[model samples]
Every structure is written in C-alpha cells, then in structure tokens.
Target: MAYVVFVGGLVVVLAGLTWFASWAKRRGRGSGVAGALAAYEEAYRTTAHQSHHELRQQADRKSESGSPDDL
Candidate 1:
C-alpha cells in the first residue's frame, strides 16, 4: 500500500542518518560532521548565553572602570 511505502522510505532515511552520525563520531572530534556541529554549538552558545567565565570577566571590567552605572 501507499502508506507502507512511505513508512519504509522514512525508516531508510532515519537509518542512514543514524549510521552517518556514528561514522562521524568515530572519525574523532576535530574533523568531519562532528567538528562542524561542535563549532556551531559553541558559536550559538557564545552569542546566546553568557558562561560563568564571561560573566566574571565582564564584572571585573566594570569594577576596574569604577562605574556603578555599568551595573
């Protein structure tokens, strides 16, 4: 039936993606799809959220400038 064919195609696509992800992982951290994903995540996090280190550095800079308005 048409439904069965559609489901089969979906399954095949999912399986291929799973395989590719595993392959990328095995290729290591600094290369291939895994590296690209890591770079993207780091960029997004840096822009979207402030880490503790970043917050501390910002606070230090404000204190150095002795500007209460910065707070």
Candidate 2:
C-alpha cells in the first residue's frame, strides 16, 4: 500500500513538471536546458565555432572579382 502511494505521488510530480514546462515554452521562455546543452557542446565539440575573418576575406575576394563573365 505504501509503495502504491509513493508511485502515485511520483507520477503526479512528474506530470506537474511536464505541464509547467509546456506553459513556460508557450510563454517564450525556456528552462535554460537548451543553453546548458549548447554550452556543453561548444566546450567539447570541434568545428562548432566559425571563423568570421575567413568568411569576410572570402566575401571581399568575391566582390573584387566582379563576376564570372569578367573571366
């Protein structure tokens, strides 16, 4: 009997948490779980960062070349 009550209480707590998460998401606020996961990936993952300087250099070269028909 005690075990059954414990399990029921656990289920109610979990359901309440699920409802709160859905409400928060609808309000345009996250639980910060995504940001935490992103930070973890950035810390451990390679190729996660972009080279802005390299991108700018490529854009400059393309502009200088005008068009392919110029060649």
Candidate 3:
C-alpha cells in the first residue's frame, strides 16, 4: 500500500511538471543565453555602483578630516 501511494505521488508530481513545461513553451519562454546575459549585466552594474558609492563616501570623509596639505 505504501509503495502504491509513493508511486502515485511521483506520477502526480511528474505530470504537474510536464504540464508546467508545456505551459511555459506555449508562452514562448524558451531557454536561451539572453536571460543569462541579462542577469550577469545586472550583477555587474550593481557591483560597480556599490564600489563607486563607497569610494565617494571614503573621499568625503578624507576631505572632512582636512586636505592632504593640512597633514
């Protein structure tokens, strides 16, 4: 009885996945490199923006502490 239930559950899960794949295909969600490139570009932009912001903040602190000529 337990084996039967397990097999039945697996069948249901697989059927659900099959249906989802079919739906995605119908919606033209085919897998391609564009999605990966977009993700990579977004990550690169975020990292660059964060580094620029930190550098600006550090420079501000240094200026506030007096210019290099004052040292």
Candidate 4:
C-alpha cells in the first residue's frame, strides 16, 4: 500500500520534472537542460525504441486513452 503511493508520487514528480525542464528551456536554462535531457535520453534509449513500436501498435486501440505527455 505504501509502495503503491510511493510509485504514484514518483510518477507525479517525474511529470512535474518534465514540465519544468520544458519551461526552463523556454526561459533559457541552456546546457543545464541539455545535459539532463542527454542523461534522460540515454537512460531510456533502448526502452524508447521498443516503446515507440508498442505505442504505434496501440495507436488504433485507443486514440484518446493514453497520455500524450510521453516526452
């Protein structure tokens, strides 16, 4: 039960981090975000490729069912 709450909190935090990164860039965070994004991209490099294909396959199943904030 506590683990589930922790995971949910983590998701929300990551979402906020994503939004903050985008906002920071707009306000000129520069290399600050570049490095972070590079690390982030590397972290998910393999999963991203697979997830890309999976998302494509699921595209027809639920047009409005998933979150588009997958960046």
Candidate 5:
C-alpha cells in the first residue's frame, strides 16, 4: 500500500507538470525553462489547428451579433 501511494503521488506530480507546461504553452510564455516546449506547441497550434483563438473569435462574433442567450 505504501509503494502504491508513492507511485500514485509521483504520477500525480508528473501529470501536474505536464498540465502546467501545456498551459504555459497556450499562453505563449516562451522565455523560461519551458520555452522550447512552448514554441513547439505554438507552432503546432498555428499549423492546421483549431483551438483557443478560433473558438474565442467565434464567441466574440456571436456576442457582437447580440445574441440574447449570451447576454
């Protein structure tokens, strides 16, 4: 049980690190230890991708159209 707990903790830590890296990448934070990963993610997002920016733009347009549900 103790071993299992230790492994679980390690996995959780690693997953958190990955999530932080991804979050940093999306925010375009490319000037620290994770710069390379951030740049790679940015490139991927810009090439044949449909996330973040696209969805935000769509939502903005919808709001501009004055949709009642959005208000």
Candidate 6:
C-alpha cells in the first residue's frame, strides 16, 4: 500500500513537470533539453556567486595609502 501511494505521488509530480515543460516550449525556452539547461544556467548566473574581493581590496588600499591625509 505504501509503495502504491508513493508511485501515485511520483506520477502526479512527473505530470506536472511535463505540463510545465510544454508551457516553457511555447515560450521558446524549452526547444532542446540542452537549451533549457543552458537557460537555467544563465538565469542562475545572474544571481549566483560574484567576486567583489578585488574591488574591496582596492578600496581598502586607497584608504590606507600614506600621504598628507595620514597624521
């Protein structure tokens, strides 16, 4: 009984995924599996890891530079 319940839930989840894929195709982002994966990667990159350490270090160095500004 438990196995049957799990299989039923899996089927429902798969069906929903298929429906979404079909919709995505209509929107032109689901042409190929590779293309869909690429789009997802691009979207992820826009909000993913960023390297700001170099800029921070430059700012810190500018502030710490010895000049007339230093006592």
In terms of TM-score, which candidate is strongest?
Answer: 2
Clash pairs detected, candidate 3: none
Across 18-57, the per-residue lDDT of candidate 3 in tens digits comes to 9988898898674554456546655777775566566657
Per-residue lDDT of 1-71 in model 1, one digit per residue for the tens? Answer: 99999999999999998998788678754355444655675777665234534654686784446569878
How far off is residue 70 in model 3, in Å? Answer: 83
Candidate 2 lDDT tens digits, 1-71: 99999999999999999999899889967737756655665677634423433454586784445677887
**Please, what are the lDDT tens digits per residue for candidate 5 over residues 1-71?**
99999999999999999999899889977456544544666787654234545654686784437668887
Pull out the clashing pairs in model 4. none
Q: Report the lDDT tens digits of candidate 4 across residue range 1-71.
A: 99999999999999999999889879876666555655675577967656655664796575566568865
- Would you list the clashing residue pairs of candidate 2? none
Question: Residue 66: error of model 3 in Å?
Answer: 75
Q: lDDT for model 5, on a 0 to 1 scale?
A: 0.70
Clashing pairs for predicted structure model 1, backbone only: none
Give the Cα lDDT of each candidate: 0.68, 0.70, 0.73, 0.74, 0.70, 0.67
A best-first ranking of the candidates according to their TM-score comes to 2, 1, 5, 3, 6, 4
Score candidate 2 by lDDT. 0.70
Winning model by lDDT: 4
- Cα deviation at 53, candidate 1, in Å, is 9.4
When 3 and 4 are scored with lDDT, the better candidate is 4
Q: Model 2: runs farther than 4 Å from truth?
A: 44-71
List ranges where model 6 is wrong by over 4 Å. 30-71
Worst 10 residues of 4 by lDDT: 33-42
> What is the TM-score of each predicted model, taking all chains together?
0.45, 0.53, 0.43, 0.40, 0.44, 0.41
Question: Looking at model 6, which ten-residue stretch has the lowest summed lDDT?
Answer: 47-56
lDDT over C-alpha atoms for residue 10 of model 3:
100
